[model samples]
Target: MVHSRVSINIDSWKKVSKANKDQIFKEIHHDYAVEDNIKKPLLKKLGKMHRDWRNRLRSGF
Candidate 1:
């Protein structure tokens, strides 16, 4: 079976879904304070993605 698309081009930072925004914050929170979590590296990656996404919106993508 074919899976539906998971992400779409967001035209603006304000347009990004709350779920996606929360996902980023959760990753950052997990990295800085969560106990026993082994995915710290993902924090940087997620942050970069979030920043890049906002940049893309600022660039009028």
Candidate 2:
């Protein structure tokens, strides 16, 4: 079984502090050893993932 490197639960994304968000990004980057050139794409992908999760929760899926 594969396990996630970072475990963060977003009960209220909007209420998440900037510091917490930064910590999440930092952990992901460190875990993946993301290249500087790919950092932007990684962030974009994370955003899309978050949006999809939020949409699913909102739609009761």
- Top candidate, metric lDDT: 2
C-alpha lDDT (0 to 100) for residue 5 of candidate 2? 49
Candidate that would win on TM-score: 2
Clash pairs for candidate 1: none
How well does model 2 score by local distance difference test?
0.69
lDDT of 2 at 52: 85
| lDDT, residue 1, candidate 2 | 79
Q: Which stretches in model 2 have alpha-carbon errors above 4 Å?
A: 1-12, 15-22, 28-35
Clashing pairs in 2: none
lDDT of each: 0.57, 0.69
lDDT of 2 by residue, 1-61 (tens): 7634433344357867978877786677677776767876666677668878879989999
Per-residue alpha-carbon lDDT of candidate 1 for residues 1-61, written as tens digits (9 for 90 to 100): 8643334233345766878867755655554675434444454455567678778978999
Location of the lowest summed lDDT over 10 successive residues in candidate 2: 3-12
